[model samples]
Target: MQMSQIVTNFFDACVFFPRIIFFSGLLSLSGCSNAVEFVQIFTGNNGPTGPNLYHFENKEQLDLSWVKSAMSRSDYEKVLSRIDFKRQVLIAVSVGERDSVSENVQISRISLVPVADDTIVDVSVRVGMVSKECEKNLTSYVFVLGTFEKPKKTLSYGGFDMDNFNAGCIAELSGQPNGP
Candidate 1:
């Protein structure tokens, strides 16, 4: 079998596989700090919804099956082609569901930290929330694609919520004196 065929088979077997993280939410890392350079692959209010974090080691393992589920084939392919999987890994972060379309998420920063035998991928995300009330819910997502180098250590993903610095919308929405 060809390499692509083998990879396809391997990915097919693991499509339902879920990676376990040591911990998530906010992480504060000490020691040499370096920001992992990343580019936004795609961001929008769409389905395939729910809070999710995914990482792929190579192009063959990167599932585009979700293309038909929530995005266009052309757009997803374009993003896939941009990734040089040989040198970099792919990481995706989803914000799950929101009550209004006025809510959105943006990947603010990406960084890595060494802990014993593993590396923690700390993703800082900024959320935009408006005071609009909606009759239905929307899934807002920011798919990021990047990772650090390897000795092939166990990798964990965590998200740090950096509230949009503007307190006006937050305050108005929460009915609090100041934004939380």
Candidate 2:
């Protein structure tokens, strides 16, 4: 080991007891941090980060529609774009006097597991939704997101809209992106 490593080892041996107590204390703080994150994960926070939920103005009361069921690869691409971006575009499916969604449920985040044989892949999405109207009130749901590819497929999507409501699939993102 290098001289610095030797010094570190000496300290590690000498101060192991004290360090353990310190680390234990930090772990408690970590639990609190994780609790906050858990709340955030389900409820979502207001910003251009984390999962994407469709939000739009209630312009003369519009109709926000959910994405259609997927039947092919193109369907996956369409759904992926809505959930992948921070500020997503929305399309109005229902014609109404109010916004497509009076209260929007942002899928703050989600995790997916796919089970498939040789010819077909069926996936279950563990989706977390926070009301855009009330961010603290978070709800989680398990959506059978129709069918799609295996987890190994690399996908890319940007933005789409139908009414003011935003709903769709997701792709794992690295870090986060700032709007252009």
Candidate 3:
């Protein structure tokens, strides 16, 4: 079989496989810190029913090891060797004309916290923003971030690609288009 065919089969097996994380609503997910494959982070404007929003893309990568460090759990890192995720957030979003919506502004780091009222994880994002809209026009819009299940209204860090990259460098070595 061709290399693409093999890759397709492998992804088909892993992507469609039934691997589940134990979650109890939006606040509680067992492996939000571990290597769960997430295709997108759900953030919206005007709550779940709003105008401004971000979409998911395949190019953007997730450094959970880096993303997880922002979490309040140091011991978790001890179990698995961790990497420093200073500003390396590779998440792709479908922001059409709203390029200015979250442009130059990247919510690179995130953490999961326990909500006192319920057994759920509250999502916190550490954003690095430099938007012209936020400067001159002073346009005001609420930017929502993170993933969730609508029926249960539960947010999660699952459904992402946490595989090793930079091997990645192979793309460069092969003279392939590998910038970004």
Candidate 4:
């Protein structure tokens, strides 16, 4: 092939490859944009002892509620003060009781998807595995989120990990020859 033809082909190849890569990158980022951003107000294993999801719209609601029963009054007030109830809300996820204190809960991702006239808040959580038997303990996590509006309008869920933990753990234990 001629040198001119070869140079032309090389330039065209460079331009074509970058466009393809740029477009694909944009496509991938578009999918990730639905993940809602949240500021973690507090997260600890000492939350409510049972699986619970709390969504509070204002400080008055939180102040009058028992959701912070597991937390100190001062600490609860501190968390409440950080929130501007008019602009943000609080979401707490309690993983309930686990077999060991070593076990932990992680709020991996929070996403919002529009459905009909409302939105669905999907929370992705993961908990550490307890390899051995231990005293039952409370495991929980909390986050402060700022949505377009209060989260009362959104349908929320504990996501897959909270829903499937028991079944998955049982399957794993039963499948082993000698499980913990």
Candidate 5:
């Protein structure tokens, strides 16, 4: 074969090899895109009826009146103690019918992971099937800095099944500065 023809063939082979490898690598990573997903968080009497159901800095300030009552303080404290604020916390909330499984299946997988220089919190809330089907399965979540306070009861709304709904919050407290 002529020298020019041999050189041309060599260049073509080199270009084709890298292009094949690059495309296969991209395909593998694309399948893992759903590894983590985002879910909206809401709080108030009506559960995102309007702008009122936005994020809140203070949990107590939340109009949880719509919610029967939060989980017991002792239980919350126990969970908090087990968590490491130095690392990001993953919180998952899943809602389902009182007796059915076709509920907040998506939000149930919420999780938290600590990234360099920052703590990441993951939350998922699922509203289950109820008379208000659309509103029932709605889910939301929030991530904040610092540990959460135990929920305290401030009033009573008789007959509501507070436990029926599931909610989770995760946050990492900022590190303290070194000694002076």
Candidate 6:
């Protein structure tokens, strides 16, 4: 090949190589922002029947009302009041229904799972009812408090016979704690 032609080809190759690499790198990074993990929760009758995902940047703002109603008034106040929202808390709400008419009930449970960056929690709830020819429905809700730019939401639903009422829900959260 002529000298001028060879020189032109070398410069063109160098320019095109970097562009290819740069575009590929950009494409890979685009997928990272939308990635998230989820946790699962199960319940018996009277489980959470509405929104299951609650997101909060500060732990102090955590709300346990939905779960507190399931227990006695005194017990509810005691258990909920002791919770330190300053620390990370995974809140799950479940409801159980009986064949006979009654008010909705809420059940609450806590775990000592460590909260880490990009952490997703899986909570399971089991609700029970009493009746010989009974039909029960259970629902569950999960709230994750963290310091993310925006909150995240996820949900699942299922039902079983009153003989062994079973239902469930799931949710996820991302980021770190901002402060109290």
Q: What TM-score against the true fold does each predicted structure earn?
A: 0.58, 0.17, 0.24, 0.54, 0.25, 0.31
lDDT of 1 by residue, 1-180 (tens): 999999887654432223333444434434533456677666544443455566666666666434223555686677777777777766766555444333345677766655556676666666566545432333343233445443256665444434443222332211101000
Q: 1-180 in candidate 5: lDDT tens per residue?
A: 999999877654432211111231232211110113333232112111111111222334332432212323564454344444333221322121122222232334322222222222333333332333323332332111122221222111100011224322221111111110
Worst 10 residues of 5 by lDDT: 153-162
Extract clashing residue pairs from model 5: 40-140, 41-140, 41-141, 90-111, 90-112, 125-139, 127-136, 127-137
Worst 10 residues of 6 by lDDT: 171-180
- Write model 6 residue lDDT over 12-119, tens digit each, in one string: 443221111123123222111222222322222223444343333333443434443433457545544544444424344322212332222223221111122233
Which model, 1 or 6, shows the larger lDDT? 1
Which 10 consecutive positions of candidate 1 have the poorest summed lDDT? 171-180
Candidate with better TM-score, 2 vs 5: 5
lDDT of 2 by residue, 1-180 (tens): 899999887754432221111221232111100000111111111112222333222222112223222123464355444342322222211111121122333322222211121111111123322335444322221112211112342222112112223322222111112211
lDDT tens per residue, model 4, 1-180 = 999999887654432211111231242121211455676665544544455556677777766655556466787777767778787766666655544333334567666544333444556665555444432433333222222345545553323235323322221110101100
lDDT of each: 0.51, 0.24, 0.28, 0.48, 0.27, 0.30
Q: Rank the candidates by TM-score, best first.
A: 1, 4, 6, 5, 3, 2
Q: Give the winner by TM-score: 3 or 4.
A: 4
In the range 1-180, model 3's lDDT, one tens digit per residue, is 999999887665433323334444433334323122322333322221122222221112332222222222453343223222231222322111122232222333223322323222222233222333333322222232343222122233322221111121111100111112
Residue 86 deviation, candidate 5, in Å? 1.6
Candidate closest to the true structure, highest lDDT: 1
The alpha-carbon lDDT assigned to residue 12 of candidate 6 equals 45
- Model 1 stretches astray by more than 4 angstroms: 1-33, 64-68, 102-104, 131-180
Ranking of all candidate structures by their lDDT, best first? 1, 4, 6, 3, 5, 2
Q: Which stretches of candidate 6 lie over 4 Å from their true place?
A: 1-48, 51-60, 63-76, 88-90, 96-117, 133-180
Measured on C-alpha atoms, candidate 6 has an lDDT of 0.30
